[model samples]
Target: MTHPDDDDELIQELALAGQGIALVKMEGRVFLRFEGVVDEAGLHVPYALVPAQGVLAKPSKWRKLEREARAALIAERANERARRELDEHVRAFVRELAEECEDAGLAPMDFLHTLADLQTSEPAGAIFDRIRQRLGHAVERQREEQHAERTRQSINLAEYPASFDVARRLPRRFIALLGPTNSGKTHKAMEALAKAASGVYLAPLRLLALENYERLLEVERHGKPLAVSLVTGEERRLAEGATHVASTVEMLDTRTAVDVAVIDEIQMLADRDRGAAWTAAVCGAPARTVYLVGAPEARRAIEALAERLECPLEVHVLKRKGPLAMEPGPVRKVKNLRPGDALIAFSRRDVLMWRDMVAEMGHSVATVYGNLSPEVRRAQAQRFRDGSADIVVGTDAIAMGLNMPIQRIVMTASIKFNGVEEEEIPAALARQIAGRAGRYGIHEEGLVAGYDADTHEVMRSLLKEKPVPLNTSGFAVAPTLEHLHRIAAVTGETALAKLLKRFIHNIDVPDGFFYPRITEDQNERAEWLDTLPLTVAEKFTLSLVPVTTRVASLQSAWEHWAMSLAKKKVTRLRTDDYVLHHMTLQEVEDICRLYSAYAWLGYRLPEYFPDVTLAQDMSREASSRVDSMLQDQNASARRRRPRR
Candidate 1:
């Protein structure tokens, strides 16, 4: 298959075609020349990850697609990683040779750049090697030995506790309330927090933080109301003379000593992206008594943390207050859905679509998903709780946030798209979602099943399976600004991206227990922010902001926020007039999150992003509008339902 016209005949004979590729029959079978090239076989250029639209007549059947193009893409991804490694090597040279450059009369011009300075295919370290050779091998060897010693001492993690003076001063005690879902362990920890004279609750989610914050403010103890502060990336409500505080885990105030601190979701120490927050809270919470509440899977991780921190720990394993049991069979149809039911789907589209089908069957529906704001999810959950909505359809967002009187959970499918491809859901996630059934006071026994026979069997099998135990690696640790600044002082480097790379590669960790983790998103954000004229601290701060870059709108807003901050301008926050006029659910959700990012940035850079209150107000309004739209959709669906 060489010429364009002959390619048609080849595709017709093979019953498969892709963009710009040639194939030849070697044996009985043929393979794709995915790499587009002017090869002898007359292959053209390869299309991207997706094949050409009209070329793929039967995509599922054309499984053999591998020639040079696919291999080239794999090489490109590998090269992308190599590029970062090359950047790191350049950073090491910058750190290890700053003094050598000064001695050789080139320090002034040697503020070495990142890999972005690479103009050709030449390696970034070649110039540094040339400098090293010019400085004489004998002098360079002695200097290298001395520099290695300094780096080892400067980047040691053995003294990590000393970084948190408030925590180091206290004789802390850990109380780990480890158990499965519906075990009431978290409730017990919250009870202790409520009873403390002064305390803080560190929740994993903003919704959970807000819910507990409101509870602390509303509940009176000893005939007097307790003033409480609400702090999270999304919003903040500072109470007057607050004795108690409820904050998202990342907002934990380790500097302020408290009588007690409650850290929810102890098992999240296994999380890749946010686990560092949990580690920081556990190691740095300046409280006399700290409650670590989460699944039993986290018990070992907590034990490792307590041992390393030299804190006393008491372990308590609790039993479920209400037993969970699988249903005998599937519901068979949407009509079989019960009033106190939570139907679980994996995607926002699936959840909304399923909600419509349920509503069209004459059931009142409320929807919750990751894209929806916490306010919206809370309101939808309220509807489900108050019997205003007969059933709730949601993604995994509903699994952990709210406490509903759900008697049964129905799984829509056993498979979900995990950002890449459709794969069978993990047993642990399915169990966590299913465990939402039968609250202690709400229902006697929790029942779980699937919407169909196959799904029901999958659920039944998953319930009996056990979750894997978490590793006892001290915990995932991320760098604080203090650590970064210390690195900068010692290494004479100013680039934030280089500082992070140094943290991962040059840091000396003892016992390999505390593995350093910097998420891919953070590194990517740092690289992009490096293009602007910003301080290392500013770049680091922007990198950590809770911005979901997957959404193009959110990504643009974050970039705009960073650019505005770089220009030293007050980024005014206002609702788009068109958004107010024609607010689609997707648009409102995006705008609501945009306001959240604004509010979050305001707290960090108050002078620049100074619209905290306005952003919060706009966020609430957007959420309320979304809630109203949900009700309107459900009402419309019910009206369209065939009345029996």
Candidate 2:
């Protein structure tokens, strides 16, 4: 004899009462057990069911069930907080990888034949790393194999200059300026550019392009005033009588031959994604004289480029005007940070955290990271340059395009996130960043140090280690529309993705001089775009839009644009009018990138996306808003905590 509502059916029915009911079992009989069984009105108090062991005392599994229930409750109570955190972090780790694995049609985790504890003695990070190995290896390996198969079929050509239209532009003079930091190499190149009546300066970043554009505008060539214009994906400031242009490397004008051209960061020929641009610039820049400026390690590659172009190359190597040295010891703590120091951290989160900490320590902070718009970065850098801000906190964005007078560089870590795992940084990149300190005329010498003892040692060793020289052969090349279209006409294959794959797999390239490669992002985008109802040229153009696949907002916007293009609808540029007070800095940066992509697409497909001018205006306004927000936020932080 047990409680009336002790059956499974009644138990489930009680579950619908909007509260929990405890159920108990004994031998083959069931019992209802609930704690303080009462409604808000106390209506069940008199008729509440109660259990008494004496009422149905029989041989039962109470001894076992009670033991398990008590043990489970007690066990959960011990180290419960630690266990809960561990469980949560593990779940998050697996969840992140699981999403990536979803495309591979595999689960990110696996089951075992035996029972295992929910907790582990190993470090959480190590365990996560171990799990990472299991989930993505197959998919990643498969991708590698696919790429390898395509590359295996790559043809070798001793002489093929189809990448650029430089056949008639040969016999050009090439001046290669190679040096360490503070060597005035850029100044030398710029001076030459200013002396030329018609010239182009190709910069690695738009910020540099804009900077050099302004520098050139204030100059007169042979007492004749020179009209300068700025051209970048974000903006194009063309003057009425422009005789010279400063543009990003990607925007290099191959058709228009200038009197002189300066290609900054020529070592970027080894860059996987944009190397083709440098190759094209080198091969197609129809200039009488060209300047190649980069590290001395790029000498071999530069020589190869000159040989291929059949240009007379004159090399100049300059020593640093000021000295650079490793710090004797670590900075150890934030309290030891000094003025004129550029604090380096790899991730945007770390940069922001360091900025706040430095702010609280009474130094007004200027921030720079990869996500900040070039305009915003320039403003933040200006504060540091003008001595309004004590120090700057940044990532590798500081490694290039900055003109700050940093006397020292204090690295907070020796590792950086490469969109994946944190790994030791390469010597060349570390030196490039460390070289930012000790600008000529700013300080006698530049110092580099790490925050802690271990990282300090790593950075010191890295600085001493020689930078790896690039290969003398096999510069990266990408296909032009002409190359792709010729293949289309030959094979009658109008699918852009197939054409791209065929180009990479079947194109003839020199064995070790120039090879073809399409970035994985572009290939992926091409595959996705091929599914849409669009022409081959349209798909190819959309594939090259400057959008990162990892960003959901960017990917969604890109897809929407492609859809609009396929529907033959006019997609006008749209934004929040730069009033992004509610959005975060990263969000604002992403909006800027979106506008940039739109501007790029508009320039390519003006008939469909005709708001390039509007997009440029909005991007500038957005950048200004971001800069204002950074400055005001720093001031607010100072107000909250005055300098000690």
Candidate 3:
């Protein structure tokens, strides 16, 4: 139960274990932090044994694999988006031109002469001035789209060199896709997993997981059901004996058995809390083969490890697959809000503010915040895709994965809070975000702009230059013991025994190796059930609880909720997070006057419903008198109901 001691023995053990950590000096002080720790246990510890200045934010090499994979997907989606935008812009122009001809009310010859005479080149001539003004608007629109095309082309060019080594023949197992950004890594991974008899694709982030799950369903070959499932920390979609499971590695764990395992973003092996999942997936996958896909920077190290472990590792480098047209037109500056444009912001509050601001301008707006439920977020994204929502304002949550056709991207701000500190997005992150514009299949081109009037000049310069290549070697950090234990717990003793028999699984984990320690906590189960208050229909919808586990009290509540829905009535019940947060806010506001803003606006901003007054008071009263209130309300409600 004791935490690992912070000492040299542990550091040396981590170093000798080939866990990516090294000794260094910072400001003359010796320091130690994860340099390439890619094992399961090393990744869980947050603070490293190092001087503060030497702390690196980079993830492990395995994570680089994921970045490369995801980067490829971004390229594909970006190209598609660009092509669509190009077609739309051209159509809009033609439509306007046709309307203009109809409104002239003159013969073609007369119209031509009138149009010519409408302006003259002579000095101080009003006729010529008027003619030039009319032509200017048309010229501006043309320039805007042309610039978009150029940006799109630039993105295409960068990806071309990355997808080259791609081959048609599918590998049986041990297919490792290695490439740089925009190389189409994930696309290939998704293809392999979809074609495999049974497989699971693991993503680093929940957003990516959801995106992969949807894509799997979309590309599913029609026949009998694909039996695909999705798993996140809070959500689970299990089908009876389902074969395909696209899940976040943190959610799936290594104890899982499958015919094939597609581990996306293997470079996340450098992550502190989550890298262990990636490490476990790579080192302990039960599948016949594990496709280790990622960027070139991480290839040598990964290949070296595969050799040491005696596992067959085949490396496939996808040369950049597509070509981008040269000298795409100049980027258009978009300081003003447009109906069809996407404004990229960095925070939830900013997304809300922008949504309200743009909505007031008579444009349909949809907000995509990370805190929203997955179902709600997906629905919001769909609204944008179908053009129901003119503007989709969001945090970095919309940065990658999902494809939306957008003509231009407006950067509202450059600063982003990376959990602990506020940092300006480097050119690499900027290029990635800006690349969202002008999807290839969606538009012929795209536009990338920064909001600061000062930065318009800088943006112009950046647009002219190629995006910098991302580093891959920086990702080889060790995994954490916490992850190893979680994997052990999920796999259970029986499955672990089977995996241990496999040579690949046996190669790793130290000698006299004991399984990861796991505490059986029933509180977690109770907490999970309390989190989502489901109706009877929803219970049926998810089919999660076994018949043996169902309780009368819980069943009655679910039945009542279901009946309320049938009657088209709202339930008084609140989401569990809302209830818990509301109480937390009340405690904050109750402390003082100035601190009230922090409570009301900071912590509980989402829970403060405008239509509900005295919400805090009601919450406090309920907490203080839960038994009494429940008894009275339950008795009265039962009396009012007819006898069953």
Candidate 4:
């Protein structure tokens, strides 16, 4: 009654114990062939065993061994595949971790060591979670440190000597002219500056400075032309016996005493990037009388500053001669646009496109944008002013001080992309731009409208409302290298720019005042220049170089210029020649900027940048050529378009 299964199990057990039949390969097949004999019941008995023939079978042992071997082979293969897959997964995970570390500016080797120290065969998600948790903790610690540093800065700024203190030492009367655009704020201030026995006009733009400088030179003091000088970052044209200086706000000389000083665009005090210059001019201008001109938004801030400085404050509110009202609907096409209409766009592409579209409608077009040189902007504005251009297309650069006699203003878009995000134009900025439509005596009324319902609504809303009053003013503080070194010693930070930032932020200012945030580009450039083996003065000059940091070609050109100067070699600027003749407007503009940067460096360090005079000359030449090219292009486009 012995079963076959029982006999196979018995044979397997004996085999495992090395007492059963051995496996053998015969005729390309594996078999449990053994030296044994079979009895009448088909069971195999071992050679050592005699009798018991019907108790076991030979086939059962062979099948059992074969099945066991196949099962073993399958299990081994499965384990090997799993090991291979696990290796690939580990490699991919490590590679991703390394890339992430590199992007985060962390050391990959350190990150790998951290992963290894975890000492657990965790899943990818678990490992990533752990890494992120560590990174979060590190970030939290850094934030805490920054907070502590800023707190220290606040304390220091409180004890720092403010511009008000500087003003208190001088005998000055402050006059603030506040109103909306086209209110004659700057006109009245410039008039006073012109009448002063000796005065300085601090303008917010080079074009404005040049405009006033020329006007002053045209005035007669005693039946003879009066003394006037033009001083900007890039160009300085000094008249003989010049008692009146017209300069950009950043170039205002705070040490020289003048009979009167006019600081135009005083609302710029709220500008986070360049407000500090306006603040400095107001607080430190050594004039007996100082004229502060800007929108009404800065009235309270200026009044507070005047009160703190103990200067007699006079406020003048000017009225607009022409009225401004919203148009009824959107402008759908350029064909309906009349003469003296300006189309405002927020981007260069839009500006050019609108200009071309209008040109095809048989209207002469002029463009004004930030990239255009001041000279080119002045020319474009002149074309609009003198009736040569029927329509003007421009960006927000027109919002500043450019004067154009337009009957109507048309906004193509309500939102602007300000490098970071698309945002609706601020009410203050909208008012400034819309106000430019009707020059007081030129147009009886100025009309403002947008291209769509949403834009029209936004424009109307902005026009009806005034900008919120300025509550805070920010300034840049340039501390001495010695002072920065001391801060570095205290903070244990080796980077000069970081130390400078720490020192600046640590300065405790009044509630309404703060240090401006340094841009990432500026900080990066500062760090780079700091690594160079240059004198403190040289480093400062390089730090203030006016090149756009975002452009790689400009940066390369600047680096070459700096290196040549460091080696005391004669350095010629990239734009030293008139090579921008056939270039695009944008390229020409970039070259003009390079020329300006060179001129700025030359003015700052004449010994190192000896070719500054040549640079300034080249800048003027390139600007004039570009302006002529623009005029020709516009004229040619107009000729090509058939009259409607």
TM-score of each: 0.78, 0.74, 0.46, 0.73
Model 1 lDDT per residue over 1-644, tens place: 13334435545544434433334333232333232222111212111111111122222233344333334432343233443453445445555655555574444222333222322222234545655665556455545444445555687776766678999999899999988789989889988999899999999999999899888877797788888999887677788888899999999998999999999988888887889889889889999999999887788888888998999999999988888998889998999998999999998889889999999999999898988888899999999999999999999887776888889999999998876699988787887889899878979999999999999999898888887788987577898888788777776778888788878776788877776789999999999999999999899999988878999988998999899889998888765533653868888888888888888888889999888898888988988898999899889988889878
User: Residue 413 of model 3: what lDDT?
Assistant: 75
* Model with the higher TM-score, candidate 1 or 2: 1
Name the candidate, 1 or 4, with the larger lDDT value.
1
In the range 1-644, model 2's lDDT, one tens digit per residue, is: 33333334444543523322334444454333222222212122211122222122122533334533433432333233533454455445545655666667754444110002223223345545655665557776666555444433443334445444553444588999998767899999999999887889999998899899989988976676679999887678899889899999988887777889999998888886888888878877778899999988899888987887678999999888888998899999888999999999988888888888888788899999988878889989999999999999999899888889999899999887765688999888888899999988869999999899998999989988877787888777787776677667655677788888877876666465778789888888888998899988899889889878788999999999999999999999656544677888778888888888899899899999999989888888878878887887777766677535
Over 1-644, each residue of candidate 4 has an lDDT whose tens digit, in order, gives 23435435644654422422333333333333222222211222112111111112244443555545543532333233433343444455456655655566665455444533443333334655676677656656665476556546534543333434445567789999988889998888888888888899998889889988888888887798888989999988988888899999989886678889999989888776677677678777879999999998888888877775678999998887789989999887778788899899998788888888788778998988887889999999899889999999999899887888988999999899866799998898999899998888888999998977788889998888857888644444445445555555555565556655765556445553545344556667767877766654566567767788677767888888778776777666544355676687777778788888888888877776777877877788878877887787787777778655
- Model 1 lDDT at residue 241: 88
lDDT of each: 0.78, 0.76, 0.47, 0.72
- lDDT at 263 for candidate 3? 81
TM-score of 2: 0.74
| Residue 489 local lDDT, model 1 | 78
Top of the candidates by lDDT: 1
Runs of candidate 3 with Cα error greater than 4 angstroms are 1-184, 218-222, 293-301, 304-308, 314-340, 454-644
TM-score of 1: 0.78
Clashing pairs in 1: 35-69, 36-44, 36-45
Candidate 2 to native Cα RMSD, angstroms:
18.6
